[model samples]
Target: MAADTAKVDPMHQFAIEPLFGSDWTFAGHNIAFTNSALWMLIAGICLWIFMIGGMKREVVPGRWQMAVETMTGFIDDLLEANMGKEGRKYVPYVFTLFMFILFANLLGLIPLPLAMAGVHAFTFTSHFTVTGVLAIMTFAIVLTVGFWKHGLHFFSLFVPHGTPPLMIPLIFVIELISFLFRPFSLGLRLFVAMMSGHVLLEVLSSFVIDAANAGPGYGVLIGGPSFILMIAICALELLVAGIQAYVFALLTSLYINDAEHLH
Candidate 1:
């Protein structure tokens, strides 16, 4: 039974085989080209084309300009709601993040040349390397902007305005922990949501297939429910893609505000 089950490669569900030789060389180093890179490239290109190609403004607004404007307006509202009038200054960075993550998540949704998060044998979305990079980037941005705006006073963020003398040390430690964990929390939230959605889709679909393989009548009965679940998961993923992007961007803007004002 184990051998028979092993014969059915779960890896095959994500049909995108690696794009390089076994000794996949990159800059004289053997580096395999996984589907993650392919999708990341797709994400990058999609962002470039949409942002640069669409918003070439002149006199009257074109279709692309209108579309771009709509997205920007939505982001503007998000910033305004969270950070008030002061938030608009951070819009450029926030919007860029929104577009990048938006495209990345959207690209993952399509069953094209790469595995969609949970569909892969090992959930790529859960890969800490990717999440770590995102976390580091956000961390660096917060540090850079904070230091630039407040210089040494940015450290004061960890020093609360109202604190008892005895609790000062304890408060400082707590604030340090919270500040340090911000990027990790942000990245994990996005990764977990995407990974879980894809996993559900694959598991449900696999169950249906496996059930059918067991017996024709059993397969038929399971097929309807399993397929429905798969479709619903796919739809949920669409929402996840948008929401995750927005959430990431929103957090980024909030971080920027923290930096600028040190509050």
Candidate 2:
């Protein structure tokens, strides 16, 4: 039993296995409906239902309606606080980002009997590739909006307004590097946080399972504390899921502000 626990692979949760028929290769590219892709699609659908289905005009809002309104207002306030009036135009993009991430993060916590059924549960955002793509999309938007609005003047963003002429070149190089690293940093932050938390949970769960297999006495002695800690960690992860989503959206809004105002 102890040996089995030792062999438990916490990182296995992040594997992107094919969801349909055996993995296929087309034109030297592997195209398969992976668990990651499925989870992403599920998250998108859930978000659509939450936002679109809740759009019923009522004089007295129900719980679901209130939840939808509160979420909308929260994102609206987030954009307005960061980008002022100009941020209004980006509500759709930012809101979509927030909903996708929030739902993905939350969905990952749902424990299904996948192993018993020869399947596996996965968290799309736990993979760096997914988060990296999201970060790149946000970065691309920033660049497009910046260049479109400022033309060649977008390059001027790398130079501080009050920099000494002699130091301008050095500052520009530093700023350029900083700008280029945004996607990596943003993606890594989310991936590491989600991955690490899930890994810890898996490890604790393994301990609980091992204790139960050993005996009722051992289960009471060991599994009890492990189970309590698991619950606490789960609650914390739920809070983190929401916070990381908000942070990602808030940072995007700030980046948009930088592009628009060049400050």
Candidate 3:
């Protein structure tokens, strides 16, 4: 029960711990080495190691090559299923984003400050900043592709080709609103899901510890239920982490396709 009583402030726990203390500030913002940035670097390293090292033209791939090929095939399938043949062109960006987010989410599970996933501070995954930055980059890529493919006609995206003149203004307003919200919605979706999952885990684990020492029989009874719930939540979080990463990248690809196709 004493251990349970050491309840970390939920808000405080979310705060980003500086990677190098106060020595890394840039302007007014806390420019400290963040847990999120650390994970980003780790993700980059993992991507290089897996993709670069696994490249092989052999008839029978080495084990590492096979693993990389399997993942690449999976991403290819996902793109084909969702975005069609044109999706192939965007594979490089999609694969990079997937690996980065997937590694960020998974590695955060390890016991290191760099493993902070949903931390609130300046860290990437915890706050919306990291997600926001990624969202903007994705948005730029999508918008660029669209405009490049269609030229000035890209503005026509908001102006449906066959709409009656009377309904044009209304539809245009709606489209504009959606376009503006794209980055915010994308960033918020990932950040909120990850943060919520971590909070639930922490809260439940605390309850389980508290329940385990209340009394002999009652503690056993209470702790049993609490422990089961914690396990369930942890499993759910694992699923959410992977699914959310996929979702973020998928939407990014879709958004880019939309800009390109005007649909």
Q: State TM-scores per candidate.
A: 0.82, 0.92, 0.85
User: All models: lDDT?
Assistant: 0.75, 0.88, 0.75
| Over 4 Å off, model 2 | 21-28, 113-115, 118-120, 214-218
- Give the candidate number with the greatest lDDT: 2
Worst 10 residues of 3 by lDDT: 114-123
Write the residue-wise lDDT of candidate 1 on 1-263 in tens digits.
64366234443443445665658787998667766666667677878888774558856788888888888888899889878898887778778778877887777667743334434333334455676677678789889988887898888898888889899899989998999999889888988887777667767877777777777887789866888888988888899889888888878877777887787
For candidate 3, report its TM-score: 0.85
Greater TM-score among 1 and 3 belongs to 3
Task: Tell me the lDDT of model 1 at 236.
Answer: 88
Return the TM-score for candidate 2, rounded to 2 decimals: 0.92
- Candidate 1's TM-score: 0.82
Residue 118 in candidate 2, Cα distance off native in Å: 4.1
lDDT of 2 by residue, 146-167 (tens): 9999998999999979999999
lDDT of 3: 0.75
Which is better, 1 or 2, measured by lDDT?
2
